[model samples]
Target chain A: MLGEINLEKVGISCFFLSYLVAFAFEVTRLIKKSRTSRALMLLFAVAGLCAHTIFLLVRSRAADLPPLVGSQLDWMLVLAWLMVLFFLVYSLLDESSALGIFFLPLVLLIVGSTYFVGQEPRAVMEGQHSLKMAHAALLVFGISGVVIGFVIGLMYLVQHRRLKRKHGQAGGLSMPSLAKLARWNRLSVMLSFPLLTAGMLTGVGLGLYSQRTPEPVQLLDPVILSYGVVWLVMAVLFGWLLRAKPTAGKQVAWLTIWGSGFLLLTMIGLQVLNMDSWHS
Target chain B: MNLQVVYCTHHGTDLTLREKLAFSDEQTARAYDHLRNEFPDSEFVVLSTCNRVELYTAQESAKNVPTHQQLAEFFAEFHKVPREELFDDLLERTGPDAVRHLFSVAAGIDSMVVGEPQIVAQVREAYATARDHRASGPLANAMFERALKVGKRIRTETGLSEGRISIASVAVGDFGKSIFDRFDDKRVLVIGAGEMAEETLRYLHAEGVRDVVVTNRSIERAKMLAGQWGGTTAPFDQLDELLGQADIIVSTTGASRPIVSCERFQEVRRQGDPKEVFILDLGAPRDFDPAIGEVDDNVFLYCIDDLEATCDQNRKVRKKEIAAAQRIIDEETDEFMQAVYHRATGPIIRNLREKWNEISQLELERLFGKLPDLNQEDRDHLEQCFNRMVNKLLHPPLEVLREEAREGTPHGLMDALKRLFHLRD
Candidate 1:
């Protein structure tokens, strides 16, 4: 009966299959390009995005909560949905650059991870107050910045490599120059630091508030400590960037990629392992 | 239709041949008169530039059209050059290739600098001059107008002309622009009178750099170069002093050794204003020391290599655009071929349709005379049914002929259609 039912059994696979098709269309443009082909590529992407949005909405409705706050199923799809939205808007503005080459893999990773990662809701976050809700929202947004910064830095390095080697700009694989990428990376760190700091502060406040209630929240957990360390690294980068005379765009891009990339890996690793303070 | 272009382009000829064959505006008018007198049925438009000398001719029939050898002979006689000397340099393209070539040239896809904006203006000027001399026909008018539209489309729809790809331009437009908002107040010091130096000075002048000081190893050369560009000449000995005062320094000297050493430039930097300075080193071994680029944050030094890499990147982008533009050309070529083929078969198709209708009318008239008691409405309905059946029977063969038109003129099929359809012309 469960296998035969369409809504619960088939929605996730159906939406994900569309994304795979859209990704294939984006790749196909490199070989056979036409105005119609380009439009079709966009059409597939929008189609997949519509299906993805619907699937997530249905899951949230069935679970009776905001998608990201509901369960692992909701959280993973929400991240992927945001990524697709960002890629679609940005790619529409500048169709020449290969933004999909970098961001699509991340979308796939999140979508793929949902299969392995369980869908149990964290008991602590089920009926959290407004301040606790603010903490989770801030953390998600902050992590999103770090993830984006990593991707941008990776693109900068690739562009810089092409320039340094004197190779022609590869067809269907152009990106912004190191100069522009570095500027974005620096801004990302600047923005991510303040948001992350506020998120951490709010988290601490929520923890203290929850300790007075029955749960007795732990402040010195490993996940909390690792997050603090990631915040500290961003703070250092931000301070150095502001004080330095002028760093080369390439050097800054490399540093941001390395630093932010490590933080992102740790965050994702924490989520996957379900260890440290973040365990349900 | 007969269309021909006798062109000495950069592909087949050198600047010397182009120059010898080039016709100024007054000379072009005289040539037009000569052409009209020699071949009254032909239409002519002469395109003369620093790089190309082309004479395009169009006529209603191929019999009056000039051959390749005849065009070469004309060029020799007109320019007073020997026939042997000019014969090899003149290349010819006829009919469809000719139209495609002209379209590419007007679009700048065939230019040395792909997608350069100047060629469109050159083409427009050439067309206007031809019109003024009464040298163009309906075909030339239509062809040139369509070429202009294609040029506009290639420029606006594609990123073919997005960046300046020359070293002189990249240095001034990219790095210089990033440093200073305006160059009108900047002191431009050019350290050589080479072609590169002249080109850099021209760009600077266009950017409104007024106070240009030219210094070369040869003062006479510097003075001559500066005089031509309307700039002051400085002595070779005062190169360091000139460098100190220059807000923007462009060195294209042919010195084997480094002209501006790290220490020498640092010394000049000490005397100069502590403000930012833009240096363009356009030498092979590099006129300025490579370490000079790292001397200070204010000194924005770009050597030939850096500017060259950027130029090369832009060339690659243009190369990509060529593929897109070629696709458009191929599509247009097929459509043009179809139209020309259909025009070729127009007489036979019209005659066949008229002949069939006459036969149907005669047979119907015979039948109606035999059956005079039949009603007028019934007779008319029978005639309509018979006409529809005739059209349906002719449809399949005619469709094949139309499809064949997309290749060449479809001359074989047109002759075959005439025989089978009992079409007379």
Candidate 2:
């Protein structure tokens, strides 16, 4: 009976339902801390991640391309998949931790956005295939880093507020120490910015290379302009982080949240609006 | 078996009264000597701390056991406390209640700060002192050893002592330790040598902090606190300089305005090596400006309100575990009482069995003398029959006595058995 079920027929709902159940288990931990609930959460997350991997594999095989460069929908799914990988690893290490409560909703949002985004395959020039793959891979990794930095920044702010309010870790919503959270937040930002900068530089190289081809890419496309603005914002944050004498942790956290959040929103919004010149 | 405890704890009396009733190590040793002289047959153990003073006594005989009033009188004489003042304040527990009380005390359920860890060590020390002074007997030793075990079981089985509840402890444990991995190498600067500052220093000192620089407006008070913690005193005028040098700052000044402003702290930060500094502001009228926390990433400034909030939350968590802890205490108390009651019947049971055996032997010897013409095998068979008859007759009464001991010592039944069997204590 299991073998009779076609893997291609498995859609977003299969893993979405699994993740929903996993998130519910995560909530139950706060109401009453139980190892059973923690175990169940892990089990469901792993199951969901397995289904997620299978879905990406099936899609990639059908499209005859890697999921990272398949299409906007596949790209978003890959991002969500990386986040699930992170959540699963962290939850397994610290079973009682509430990281899933913060991370799962964002994963769900990205996965859900894939429903509205275009799924048509993007055509690449035969000779430029390797460059496109590298560009997509770098951007995917960089964007995922941005997402992680955003989440960590948000966690830092929440932890800082709790410490400042002098509330004990309440409702089983235990967080890492503010110092540790701040350090991770800083690391996420510091690492993501360089990856994003390299990704942007590579995109510029691709754009210039395409200018000499029969179908030259438009530099003033709304998508390219918006991405450039987002990259510029990130660069500013990067400069401030380097020059500032260890800026207040809260300030760094807030700045990271805005910078990374803006980048994610712009990327998702442009894809959903179908205003991109390159991928479309 | 009799057990009694005359105590004044934070539950019934204030700290001042407990202080009056408290005994020093020297005083406790001397008191044990006096306790032995006054009640030669009784075993004694005295537990004295800032929160409570308890004297536990156990005796084999009821007539020689000290009364609650007698213990109160003894405390009055030994500690120089007035009888009228202490008589009403001292609470008494007897028998099972006494056992339950000690178990609860050792478990930290009866502490002023519920689930404080010091009480367990205090109880251990008290038992050890009694053992050293030769004031404890077998009964006292058994009770104390079981109490310590119960304390450990409670800690393992419940989340009673999971969180630190005091302001000083919460500040250090929740925030300070999170900032710095080790305290021994950190330079600590304590501002304003007051009670709160001293308490915070005590926790820091316990965390391996040695190079303490105490600065206060009152030089004498600074010197006193510095001397207590084996720290050196810095001049009050050099607070800025001290702030620049220290890695951890504990400030509890009673100043009206903010002592450390954002701008002033900025100057301090500029001069110092860029390292993490944890500032515990324990003042009510807020010594450091709240904005100072936002001054830089390395500065972690927390006031009393912040620490108190964590303490309050921890107290609530501990309070939730009390029912579970109490259940353990109840089960253990019942088991202990049954054992004590069973022990109370041991000698009587032995005596009754011995008396019956002796009577059977005497009867068999007489029968043998009267029936000397019987065969050797027949005489052996007769002796076996006589022994069986004696055992069968003794079984039912002894079984009933053992059953009664399970609930409690069957005093009336025991008395009847003693009279009928002519048993001695």
Candidate 3:
């Protein structure tokens, strides 16, 4: 029965539209902060996340694989799912923290990118398949960390700018304080770098284990090299964050934005654009 | 029959004059006594707060209500202020306008800091005081009870009192809290023993700040302020040392020049590892140089004008709620006035009913005497029928009189009815 599952009703467009409307409501909330708009924003976000989860499940059933291991398209959608999930949970905790303004756009971007990305599942090595799954899973969770870091960095910058400009707290828009944002930003960088590092080590181990397979994974693979570059970028960010003073919130926020932004663009561009990667 | 408010508020009066006119607890009692003596027939409720001094009076007879000038003279005589000095600032509102003004004041839109909650309590206290003094009557009771209800409705139904608007509150709540997550352990350095500093300290203390070090040229004053806050004081000469250690600084002084220059602040920063420090310069002339804010990323220096800009913006946002609140106030005012006017017609209405009943009774008596052989049951039945007919006859004109009273007192219609029916007042 699970093998016979079909996606006749749900699709990426369903959640995409929900997220788009949520983002619209969030933008409207910026102009006029009201509980109605804030509630609408959360409602749509939760709806989008629900549809997003169903969409992933339907695709997973169709592919006979988990969404993270299904394809680049499924992978990106899963990333968006995590983001929308984060937004829904955090927004519940803080009814109106202006988080949707920073979060929903990223979700929309990731979900929208799935349309252009590859939907066909990658060819898995029959013997080392679980290792490959582990590799993809770590990278997925690592990228989630970076996405959150990017969002927190954006919030920090916004709050810092608001304070420096001496604007009164806007009526409906309440962002996290610069102090809290800075702390979250630092934690994201610290936590994500190790996740990405462990992910890199697992991918290397997976490649090394693939020597017994028919198509032995290459050392100079584009997938490996591209990800290696991302790791280097994250490593530098991680190193800088550790040495930076706690007082340097604005600078830390800027660096996190840059690091996380670069990581997202490179990873998304490689998969969606079908850039010359050995995995494809 | 009439409601009038003679108010001298922060809106139009000089602050110094308001201070002089403000009623202490004893002064309020004395004023109530004088008001009772001067106007024996009037109902008076005095609402005296730091922002306003208002005498609200409700009179049973509109014809003999005290004039605005008389109230102004009363204020002058009681406070010993000159007549000319107090008269121009004393404004008057009567009828529905007076009711609307009271509603607005109770709801806090008319306060110096719009939507401040303190005014509601102050208004409530005034009403309670008036009742305690045996000054408040039925009309006063109705007005104040409804005013408090209006205040609560406005507060709940609208976002009037949602955010902080005062300078010290805004400084500590919005700006300070945004910069620091916890305040209990944050070392607070207060430079100068001024009101703004104390106010800011109050907000900080509420935020759980315990370590407060006050420094001023007058070390004795600094010690006094520190003692009140459960902290210690430092000499003015140690301000530079204090600056290096403080995580938060609030300065307000009468100095002619900047107390902390950029170079001097830089020297202090160099004495220790530069950390996040929030500085509030609340002085008119600015005790800290503006350039000190630009010294480093760790130093957040805000002056009076900067915080005022935010306060002004917040105040403008609150002003938008005025229209929303006014809609409620307008509806309430009309309803209250109509009720007052309807109450005004109470005696005439009773008299009209009585006059018609007397005429009907006399005619019934004549008919019963002529038909003396009629049984008691038949006679009662006839009388019941006759009474129903009289009520049916009076219904149209009486209903008209009641309807007219809703729009206003209906003085002309009442007089006309009295003349036509030969009804006594």
Candidate 4:
């Protein structure tokens, strides 16, 4: 049976089904604190992650490029895949936690949105392959940080509300202490903003380098401008976080949600629109 | 065997009654001496705590076992309480019910704060005291040991005792720890030297608090409390300055009016650098004004009502684990009862076996003498065959006795076995 099964034929449906089952198991665990459910959830998550990894590798091989620069579809899948990696690791380490309930839906959103985005591979500018690769890698890692920041911020707000309302830790919705969440949230933004800034700076460098080549890229591209605007918003948030005294955790959580949520939305929305850009 | 417990706990009796009925160390020793004189064959153990006063007694014979009214009368006479006033509050349990009640108490399922852990140690200490005074016999030892084991099993197998349920602990652990990362570096200022304040300080001290300044209207009381925790006393008139200096404040005064109003706290905050302040107001009438919490983002104020709300939520969470805990208790109780019942059949079974064995030996010796020409191997084989026949004959009645013991003591079955086999107990 194993020899007869074809991995190349595995579609988004295969991994999507696995993740849905895993998420359902997470929900069941909350209702009935069962170690079996938690173990099964992890099993399904690992299976889905394997299939997802193979799918991305196959797509990258077919395109003759890395998945990060293959297409908007591949980029979104890679991002989703990274998040699944995070979720799986965290779930394995903390078996009783219900983080998958919060994380899996976002993964599904990104993976599902890949269908509407462009699938055709973009042309790699001559002698600019490495630079473009660096740009894409930086942006992916940076955005991954933002995604983590958003999730931690969400957890912080939840923990804050529970503490403020004087409700003990919710039965299955246990989270890190407010102090720990605040620290992690601060670290996420502090680290991600610099990487994002570097990624943007590299993109500008790529833009400048591409102008010297025969296929000169426009400096005033709408995609580039939109990215710059998003970067500025994050930079402002980053600055506020650094300068502000350790404020109330709820305020920090709200700022992180808005900042990271905007970045993710703009990045995915711009790519889906297929705006003319040197990278794509 | 007969076992019973007469008890008054927070569930059915008020603190005043429990206090009046409670036994101190000296009283417990004196009571045990009196009990030994009054009832020579009985075993007694008294468990007295702030929340409850329980007297457990076990006897080998039902004729000598203490009745509910008698135990109540003993309590009335011993504590000098009027019989009518104390009798109604004293509840009684016997036999299996008594065993189940002890298991529940040791496991903290019967506590006012369900799943509190102090009851386990309290039960253990009570048993130790009883043993030290030579008041506990073999039956009481077996029962109390099993109760302690059941308490440990419940704690490990269920999440009943996983969270803090006390008001002071809930305030410090659930809310205070959430605000600040470390307590050792924070300055702690206690506003009053009330019991609640000292309790809160105890919790904080366990969290590694070092810098503590206590201020109360009575300087001597403040000094006493501060000296207890290795802290220094501060003048009550310098409350605002101390408030500005401290990061965490615990106020538990008996004052009828709010001590720290919003305007006063706001002024104190303005004098200090903008930093986080965690305040626990444990007074009933509200030591700190409720408006102080809304005055600024830095002030994280929680009063007794807030802590009680958290405790209520924790109690509900603990309540969810009750069914699981009850299942464990039921299984343990049944096992213990079965053991006790099986022990009751021990003497009859032993006598019956010995009587049959003596008859087999006599008959075998006569047969060997008659069959002198038989080989040694054949003789040995014949003896084994006779032993198997005797075992097979005894199996049915003994099996029935063992089966009956599962439900109860099987005294009637033991008596019938004794009569049929002509065995003496």
Interface RMSD of each: 6.9, 3.4, 1.4, 2.3
Lowest-scoring 10 consecutive residues by lDDT in candidate 2 chain B?
Answer: B173-182
Give lDDT tens digits, candidate 4, residues B299-386. 7888888888778877777899999999999999899989888878888888988888889989999999998999989989988988
CAPRI-wise, candidate 2 is incorrect
**Per-residue lDDT over A185-217 for candidate 2, one digit per residue giving the tens place of the 0 to 100 score:** 888878888888788788888899989898888
Assess each prediction's global lDDT (C-alpha) against the native. 0.76, 0.86, 0.86, 0.86
Which scores higher on lDDT, 1 or 3?
3
Residue A92, candidate 4: Cα error in Å is: 6.1
Which number leads on TM-score?
A: 4
Residues B281-329, candidate 1: write the lDDT tens digits. Answer: 8887789998886666456677888888888877877788888887776
Interface RMSD of 4: 2.3
Tens digits of lDDT, candidate 3, B244-358: 9999999998689998998999999988879889999999889999998878876778888888888887787788888888898998889888888999889888998898899
Please write out the lDDT profile of model 4 over residues A112-175, one tens digit for every residue.
7777788888877788788888888888989999998999899888766666666655445457
RMSD of each candidate?
5.9, 6.8, 5.5, 4.3
* lDDT, residue B117, model 4: 93
Superposed Cα RMSD, model 2: 6.8
Clashing pairs in 3: none
Q: Who wins the DockQ comparison?
A: 3
Q: What CAPRI-style quality would you assign to candidate 4?
A: acceptable
